[model samples]
Target chain A: MIDFKQEQDGAVLYVDDEQNNINSFRSTFRKEFKVYSAINAVEALKNLKSYPDIKVIISDQRMPDVTGVEFFEKIRHIYPNKVRVILTGYSDIKAVIDAINKGQVYRYIDKPWNNDLVRLAIQDAMDLFDTRKNLSDKNESLQSAYNELDKFVYSVSHDLRSPLMSILGIANLAEVDVQDPKSLEYFQTIKGMVDKLDGYIHQIIDHYKGSQGKQFGDRIDFNKVVDEIIESIKYHPSAQGVKFQVNLEQSDSFLSNKMNVKTILSNLISNAFKYQREEETNKFVEVTGTITSEKAEIIVKDNGVGIKEDKKEEVFNMFYRAKQDETGTGLGLFIVSEAIEKLAGSIDLRSTFGKGTEIKLILPGTSE
Target chain B: MSDKLSIVIVDDNEIDLMIGERLLSRVDQSIALTKFNHSTEMLNWLQREDENSFTTNTIFLVDIYMPIFNGYYVAEQITQVFDAFDKKAIIYLVSATIEISDNRKLMLNSRVEGYIGKPVTVSLFKELIKKHG
Candidate 1:
């Protein structure tokens, strides 16, 4: 959607008190650029306003009404983006210093200037202008594309869930009516598959929401948020018989996007529930959250099945599931990492295979 | 008979309508049920009723996405009609959308009492009945 590589033939404006100098400058660079000649500062200002695309503004230092530095300084606010150059035969050090400091002149060429040198300087200015414009245009289009993708992800996931819900609901209704042991088992299988599909859909939605970028603020209640997340996960099938301990310490009010924190916490907590070692009788997940004036720190530790030493680094990669478990979407930790990065934070994970895992996250307490 | 709560369900999708009807019946069989495939038809039915005819407690569960008039517009029209006759009714918005920001503006309207995501279930329907029925 962006044309960053396309070449641009930018315009140049020459301002001078003498018509002969303006004519000669135009004749020398007319083929390379579209040249506009102005007889004085008044006319130059008018042209600058009318033609905003004029990339270079070259003016003679000596003029009847105003010096080149004065003219450049005057138009700095009006056409700040334009590249400015001064032409003067008189070696006035004050004028040169003023032009450099106040006027923000890019370069200065002596009167009876070398045509080749002036031409090169103008070319360089145009290139710089084109590069800046191209970068900004590309950024705008990229931002818009991301926005569209977010909307598409939301709608598609939402629509997909509709039919899946219908299937699940119908199965649920049928399960209630079925009496035969074999038939009931069949219905239970259907319910299991539907629930798995529903979980996958929810993960997809959460992945998109996590990547939507920078939806954080100053009003966050960590205690209440943790309570809600624990409540929801406690009801899940995988969380059966798993114990949770939450400890929150905050002397100052925490400020960040509550949703992002919720996502990160929920994913980590859910993973703790999902990957528990079945044989291990003592299974527990501990979360400690501390908030200071500058930062909010959270550490989630789970005593269950842990990641292999070789797969530690790759765990954060998108769709990189370490285990062959059918329930793992591999997007859970990836979303966690993304949300942390967006919050201008960092995450450190330590784990011992077959023992336990602990994840530490430190995020900015205030919006940057 | 007039004391029974009336439930009005509107959805363009046939399968969704059938599933919703089944779910509502599963929740409470005695609820007087009315179904509409089009939001315009639903609006018209409400507008055509006599001024004092709204005696029983009524609840509307309208899908947010539809062809002609959306659930938001239907909710606004219902609010106006009911307000003119000094009546009270509950309106709930239903959508399959996971994007919370999409329906945020509609959710702000005073006429809308709640928002429900699909597919409609007996438990959710039972909760709705207990809260509004």
Candidate 2:
């Protein structure tokens, strides 16, 4: 209930064909609450439009034109939240009761209704409106908060990471000047540590983005997205010898958020590149997409150093790296999983220790 | 255009400014470099018409994040100043800013040729200068 309620202002609307009934209702309830009265169905709708703040609407059943139930049903969609109370005679009770769910009527009033009973019904309806309005207002604030967090994440990505890049740049210049073996090794170590820290920061950002709720929709072309991702990731340090093979059969349309799809693909593809075994000469990552109207199924198969049997389940855990000594941030698979979850998708991983790893994903789309 | 190009580097961080100077000097010893630790000061220096005219075929590397005004705003002021002075220069928004909006915004500015991320390698610098220089 709203803490500040002004009883003097009009909060209840009464509609009846007879002027005497309208006058009677006004005289009885005018002191305790404000009341608005309309003589016909046309005037009743006008009253609702004129006084949008009126919480409760009461209409007499024996109107000359439309019945009370018919009037309420016609205007229900326009003022679905407005407390609809039907005042009907004994014969009209069945019609009024039936319209309760259809018209979202709050209650029914008998023709010889008591003043106290009518007053209580109107008060209850007003309370319902207050509760609903408060909930919707809270939802609006949550949406605003979500937007604010998006901006904060953008700031944190730039503000917190730029200084680290500067340090890395300076360190690159220092390596050229410092020729001593010990100092050269120190510089290499510094770069390694800095690079690791940078990886952590990126994963943290991705985690936040992935864990967020579903995003806006844009129709996705799997072939185009896969090609774009491979081109972008080809510049990574570990992408030297790895060959990318892509096959997509997507005649039917699939709709999804572009960023979420990119995140999932990029993490899986990059990990394929990063975890490749040097001994394996023909290193390759194969990506296949089969999209139907309802969902898209993607498979990323890599002939790289695959995850061990015991550690397969643990790969999706944050900061849990399968290969500890390989300068890898354990958050890549975790990020991918989060992105998949956000899209309401599922993933299945199959791998052999020395041979390769294959990850399959089924992402749902809007069903036609 | 001259064989030895000029560079006007502006950054709030003193260390980044020095690193840029060192890296560029290593690329071409004879290249003229004018460094500024403040963006607004760089604007003031650009507007000083009484001094020797700042030459054309120069590259302006402006840091994106700064006090008072951002790099995009500074780029706007520089573009205006250049147009007024009838001076021609290319602006490359140099920063570690991970803002995705930069790509769209970069395309909007005619003066801004490209965006170069931090610790820009010798190969990347050489590639950029080779294409534009």
TM-scores, all candidates, are 0.84, 0.79
- Candidate 1 per-residue lDDT over residues B1-133, each given as its tens digit: 3353777889887778887787777677888788999988888898899766664567888898888898888888888887876556788888877655756767667878878887777787788778766
Task: Give the alpha carbon lDDT tens digit for every residue of A1-368 in model 1.
Answer: 01122234668889999999987887777766788879999898888877776889898988999988888888888777788888888576568767787647988887789988898888888877777788889999999998898677866776777777667767777765568889888888888887777777787777666666465664777888888988887888788988889898987877887778888888888888888889989889898988885888889899888988989999999989877755677788888888888888999899999999998989888844
Q: Over the stretch B6-40, how does candidate 2's per-residue lDDT look in tens digits?
A: 78889998888888888876676666789999988
Q: Could you give candidate 2's per-residue lDDT for residues A230-345 as a string of tens digits?
A: 78778777888888888889988777777788789888878878888889999998888789868899898988888899999999998898776877787788888888887889
Q: Which residue runs does candidate 1 get wrong by more than 4 Å?
A: A1-8, A41-53, A60-82, A86-114, A176-184, A215-221, A253-259, A279-282, A294-297, A308-314, A320-326, A340-355, A362-368, B2-4, B52-55, B102-104
Best by DockQ: 2
Model 2 Cα RMSD, Å?
5.3
DockQ score of the complex predicted as candidate 2:
0.63
Q: Which candidate leads in TM-score? A: 1
